[model samples]
Target: MAKKKKKQKPKQGHPARLQQGVVSMDRVKVGRGLDALTGQFVQWYAEYRDDPELALMVLAAVRETLGVYAEVVGLNKVTDFDPPKLLAVLNSMIEFEETENPEAASNELGTMIYMAWVDYVEFLRDTNQWEREFESLDWFQKTLEAQDPFAGEDEVEADDELDAILDSEEASIAALAEITAMPISTMGRAVLSWVLAGGSSLWTSLPIDQFVETAAKAVENDLPAGLEETRKGLAVALVLQALEAVNAVTLNPQAAPERGVRSQDILEPEDADSFDVNFYFIQACLDMLLEQPGENDQAALEAWGLAALWIVEAADGNPQHAAAPRDEQWSSEVWKTAQVRMHELRVLGLLESGEAYSLPNIVRLAVTDVDDDIFEEDDELDDETLDAIFGPDDVDEPKRLKRETPYTGEVLQLKLTLKDSKPPIWRRVLVPMDLNLGDLHDIIQASFDWYDGHLHSFYENGFGGTTYGPAIAEMDYQKNEAETLVSSVLKKEKDRLDYVYDFGDNWEVRIDVEKILDADGGQLPRCTGGRRMAPMEDSGGIGGWEAKLEILNDPDDPEYEEVAEWCEDFGLDDGEEIDPAYFSKEEINANLDLEF
Candidate 1:
């Protein structure tokens, strides 16, 4: 017995799309990029805010720079652009001064906070550095700055509550703001929320300053509500855990390390909250829609749609993917999902016309009756492609090749042998005159075993044969081209010979040609596309041939004797030798001048 091989199952995990690495504080690539500012504005956050602003800028810059890097560089590094949920998706709004803009949608919540802090700190230090830098950028400079790399995290974690060691109350409050900026919470509880939700991280022990400002924003922003909100965070974490369940999303340490957090883990099967844990989970799906719209499948489409509806409904329309105004269609996952499902329904033949194409059309196509393997393709070509390859003038050719010939017309023969049949009985045919390269193709079809559906092209000789040329396809040939069958090939004396394809179904198949005419026969005429119609009685067909044959008498009827003898005598043979006695001496004399 043959041993059965096991099919390899797809492994689980997210392919890291984002890239991150540790850098020493001293040797890191560059620092404080936006030190100079163009005039025109306020320095309230920096001059008046001072210490709190410094702490804020540290994180603000980290977040902002990471975000800018994401846009210019793209999200390909972290999650292979897969989807996930962020419980903080709601909280992320607080970081942005304005969330409703399209061009603004590209702004990183972290970057916005960082730049805002930078603006504030610079002013406080009596330094207009970053603003000046930002001001001097030409459009080209802005584009280049947008691609700058992520800032280093000092290669060290506080390892302890960073907020507790702060000095004044204002500074403490600033730490609280910064705390929320990072996920400082712990293995789970958003540290900012840990402080807000009553679970202690380092924030609880911090001076009164920490909670003052951001806590006010936290309460004012009112991200979700109660444990329902924290529960939402837990829910998202569960999604991440489920990455191990379905086994498609895993951390890509090799490609991207800790920052490699991916889609599968973002929305793991067993996880709770779903999006509140991390918005990128869903954003990843949306990212896919953004990057590649035509890749959506049934499973992926459904998952994305449901997740979009959930996030939108759960957020009550206040989506993190949304910026300030909340009306933008491209920025909302719910809006994006709805667009895709509509496409799926439309293509599935579920929806009617009138609407424009959506991102889902880009993600997945609709299917009616699919076999188990959705990817298998059939061997039929679409009409558009057929028209394209052959072109209107070719498939619908209006011209024919004209050839001059001697009085006696040319003839070609074809023979076929089957692989399994014993003795493989077959049929033969001979055709006449003025026929060009394309004409021989049809004559061969009429004389031998051919299929109804396959396309065919014919050659006069083998590969390079001129007169007979290659048959267009195997099953069917052009009638116009088939009209002028060649008796011989046009070979050049330069005799620079090259290899060519020999025709027919396979190696053993062969053909022969003969040219002979009585000296008294009139000169051959040039073939026009014009040709006499095929006799209705000549073959079995839809209306006449098959019906006519069914009602015709048998060959033994004696009346049919003439027809049978004509068929046998006129047919071409497979290179068979003919007795001289069967032909006049004139034929043998004419052949004496011929050369291969």
Candidate 2:
């Protein structure tokens, strides 16, 4: 269970003594502002107690206001808030809304942002932290009343033009030509010729070596005249590299080559073969390309390469060959959800227009640059300067394995024992030999009746070995849990691995391969044995859990009632009677059957 940090009240004359233009040399206090903001949320929620959804919306607005305030002021501590700071935060928010999604800016979103600041000021005053003597809200009202709401009409008009271009092929081409400083006719002719030469499939279907040679030959013989030789070489190189990346994903559909990207991390390779997974993989790659279009030449080629591939895979009149059925044993809800989302994309005209040989939507996206004003930093800052200003954003490369053998008709019966438990809590289950660590994590959650609310990882050798888990920002790991298979780590009987869940609570489970069995044509992942119920979430660690059990077992204890109430909140049992020895194999198997 994760522990919340205790909030500390502000000392007298802290920020009150600091004069204007003087940076406070105090050590940066973390979580103090967030605690105060949370208190403000409680106060706001009290008014809308009957409407929980409205209360949630208010909470979201408060969070957004806090984020924007942090970006504008470079600090989030509420002690830093003053009249001048409030005005700047509000003005920045309004200008940002007006620039991006102006329609939303004119609606309740703008009003919500304004009211959030008002609530914060009121909270400050109520807490006796409002150091300024002036009438802040009244002054803010008068200031806003004097401003022009339609100040950036010309900028808005330009934004509207970009939006229009995003929906039209000819407009997109013209915009691309303008941005690249290329002749419109030459750009148009090149795109037409590429589409004529089988569009995306020509690049995707051929072997890597053949595609590289083919692209190089096309640049020399078939590219439009008047294009610079250097530009042509760059284009071919970028497209070939992009094609190679997509092909790598097609080959290893389960691997998360790009961490922190949810679309790329969700699918398991066992869910389907390369052919069945190709369409979604290509879409994920295209999303990455658009989200982070590198330097100019690289960006243009990426847009062209990925956009063409997407058109071939998703557009009408160009269907991939039918794929064979994947292993029925590997069917899962995650794959089903991916399929549904894919259908939604097509229905919403995101991936396809239902027109034969449609032009790519991403071409316009590449040309129309939408600046993120809130998070924008100075472009003039060099890499070293930026690194000095902010901390270095470097991470170790994730570990990967080369699987040479395919899954045979084999299953592993494993015993998972919870570490440091008094009477012991454990589960024994059968899983396929080829199950990835990601799926194994899910099974562990099911076996233990955990809510799967926290991050988890599997260790190959031990704590010293490779770490496999989901991609989290700034955290280093050896491999992605979804991509590393069970067989790769535990090959034979008696092989062992350690699984840790809820990093805060640090519940470690020891997994030992008990037996290697042939397929008996029965559903795997069903729990065959176990002992005792798992500990409640957020119950601290093993020590905390033991303390709670002690309290619950004794009615006369001072903390008994409180501990009992907490247990009841988890739907465990009535305060009077608790069963730590409970084990329900049938219920566990039922959930596993549904999940896997």
Candidate 3:
């Protein structure tokens, strides 16, 4: 008879298995504060539990609010509740909602969450469990009152009419025609006057009648006077709105078109806070606007010039007083000055023109023109002069030739190794040579189970070489990663690239082209092999990772419990100690299939 296998004993502190998909709470651990809080919550919940709908609503609100707080702050006790912490959580929710769904005026889920917190706080006070007397609910009440739908119903209705007019293309065209008919000098002077009176702020804050009156005086035109009740008034209003919109876009490229621009976004040259930079940016925008012939472009330029002049006027006081009187000679001098500024702006890569007429939408301004002719050898200049102009001889290296493509069915087997990782945490992936760098970035993220919550970049040669990444305002990049194909950078078996994610932690990966092979007709861009688990994001880089591994390896370590808890929080643990050498090729490939 075969010997019977002995039943293995369960390990100490092992979590109980789920029964019928229900998690067993018998083995779950709860902190003293959490236990007390829950006990009170249960009693409070019982009061409304008779009405199932109200009870469910309360439960969901409480769960979502507490859940987000726990996710953001790792809140494990009632003592974690504080005004600043709550404020941070609230801001995160608002920013996320705004970014994900810009059309929504307010986050309803966030409102519910706040309401739940208020109720919980009230419960704590009634039960006499509240110890932080300084934390007030008055601010929360005021915020809720401000968000009340009925508070400003009439004002909202009035604004709706103006908003509709602004949204209408026909109205915009009429307004543009009116603006274009006015002399450029008149427009410039109006802008100057508007700037002296306090730019967009004063205009946006005034009543409609007052704003129309002010606009008329600035333009020295009688068209907008007493026309606040007519179509002409709407034209004036549209011009003001367009000016404000252009100003908003100029200061912050990321500012949403529909939202009200903040005062903080506007940088005054007289403020001494990065004044020179702000002033130059404004000048660059004006120069760019002048390059295009679109009526909207001209109008935007006038608005921008007004802003620029305002900065100058505010700094030095009434630029007209400096005395080049309005004349044909004065106009020529002004034109020459603008030309010089335009050339400077272009050389700095701070200004560029698009194919169509639109508002001045500037993004990704480079400090220095990467393709400047100074890098090219000059036959007229001697070696010393050439060296002075071009820095050094070694810097004038030949540019890499891009691969000529009518891409064949080619696959690149890439080996991505985490930099400075001992035992070399790595992954082997097969990707199509024609795939864009952005998609490759996604594959890399998925392979390592990275959250992709931070900024990332690909360097063609190395960190200081040609950069490929998302286009961010004021950031210089050689090409957009989403538009650059992998073959453009890596065309051979041995070609390599470097990638870095999370600038703070600086996690680096070196990607090498290990093999060039013909396509096998299998699913492309799939992971073939990898070793070890990826380090948790924000784990303080390699040094912190090493320390974490040391603690994880030894259960008896003083900080092992805390470290294990953190791992659980990040979903790195599944009721078992995390293995340092863990890797699953099938799992990675499955994820890659889903991603690709």
Candidate 4:
């Protein structure tokens, strides 16, 4: 949880400035002024927040006010008078005297910014263009990347294709219909062409990459919200949504598939000869399952169950996989619901009506787990449930292989995003999933200086629960090897994985815990599951410490732009004034490529 670390109150006689003229004053007088300024700013912003145009108007007015205030303070350049920047200057005045407590300084900063925004919107309302401001609401979206911290809104990127699409609405609308109606194989091309023509960039000012990520997230989030008919929009949306769904399931422990359908398609290259073909089917299955949740669970599961069997049977059922039948006695409400789905194919008569429906029986029938419980109780299983799965008659004796080859190839990519902080607050570490959490830990400890934090995030296919099986796993290793793990038991990585962010301010800190594990018996060194620092190749010195520190310290290096902006716009300066943080030439020397 984010603790709003408190501010230290000022002592008697401490003075706070208003960044206008000589702000030197007595403590009580300064506090009263700061409080009034903050209250007014907040009030202005609060009144017109719902109306974007009005909000912008008010914002402009506030900026003018600040600019005038700066002029009063003997500052000629008003361009540098951003709300955050203004507050920082005020804080600095108090700090120079050493009379303001950290907390008091912070509150002053917050209150001033609050006023600036309020004033800005009121200015907009006075200007009279409400529609544009209303549309600006789109700019506030999480993915929109309005670079200039002082810029009132995000700028849209112009893609030529989008221009054409927006220019010809009727034609574009017709094209969209075909895009959706067309088969998936040919859909990408249509989507490409349509998006090129759709002027989607005009929709918001976010950068293309973030726009895509944001669009993808939007589409994925809305997949279940209800599909709209935008040709290219839906196409890109599904693609990103699929990736997200895959990632989500890999991270979080969601309720079992609504239809109780389990996908055993391992994406590893060694076992994946026709992965593309099976992958296509998996995508289809997910779409059918996730988007059409209105259909009965059993009905959907049966259809997906058939699809799973179809893949297996296409190769004569030799995949060496087994799952409790949908009709099996698995003791999960989620699974039970999936068991009796009346297949969509059956309802639509598509199964028997078309040439595509004639796949062989081997591809149709899957082993429905009957009365036996093959999954272990790793997550929710009590002692009694554990005994049941491992009972003498429940599972057949295991066959030990004479040779167990360790995986040296990359099977899964571990990208840790410390959930608590902001984005790209991550590490992309590649390793054989088989490495233990302890080993991963040593590697992490060597790479970063998160000295006292513990715990890490772990998940596989979004399935987290006890009753370890193929979908769940853990971080610590089993004293000995005879165990099975499930993706469901891993920590919540659903939709987006969540990892332990126990580390303190430096962000390099991993919480005070040890290790992480994956679904396959593969292990990661017992390091906290968060974003990795620069890899060894990029780790110029001290096992990447110097490299991370360089990137960490000089954030404006094309690398730190986003984070740096977020810090300032949000007043995350290292207890300094915002002016030096955003506008001072020396502070942004890195941005100017200036030496010294």
- C-alpha lDDT of all candidate models, in order: 0.29, 0.51, 0.51, 0.31
Ranked candidates (lDDT, high to low): 2, 3, 4, 1
Please give, for residues 320-364, the per-residue lDDT of candidate 4 as tens digits: 122434433333543433322223322211122232223222113
Give the per-residue lDDT of model 2 (tens digit) for 12-111: 1112221213222111121334544665557655653444346546555655555444433434354454444545555555666666676876575556
Which digits, one per residue and each the tens of the lDDT, describe model 1 over residues 1-596? 11111111111111111111222111121122222221212244444544443544454453344333332222322112111122122123333333344454465544454345344334423543232223222222232233321211111122122223233445444433322232211212332232324422323454334433333334333332222332334333332333223232333323211222333333232222222223222222233322212343433433343333332322222222221233322235544544544443333222233422222211111111111011123534333332222222112221343234444534333232212222232223333434554444433333221211122334434544532233322222223344443433322211211111112112122333222333333322211111111112122222332233333336455545543332222231223322211312222112211100
Q: Residue 285 of candidate 1: its Cα lDDT? A: 26
How many steric clashes does model 4 contain?
103
81-186: candidate 3 lDDT, tens digit per residue: 5544454455455555545676643546555655666666566656676555432444444443343322123235434543453466565344333323333212
- Ranking, TM-score, top scorer first: 2, 3, 1, 4
C-alpha lDDT of residue 558 in model 2: 97
TM-score of each model, in listed order: 0.19, 0.36, 0.36, 0.18
Better of 3 and 4 by TM-score: 3
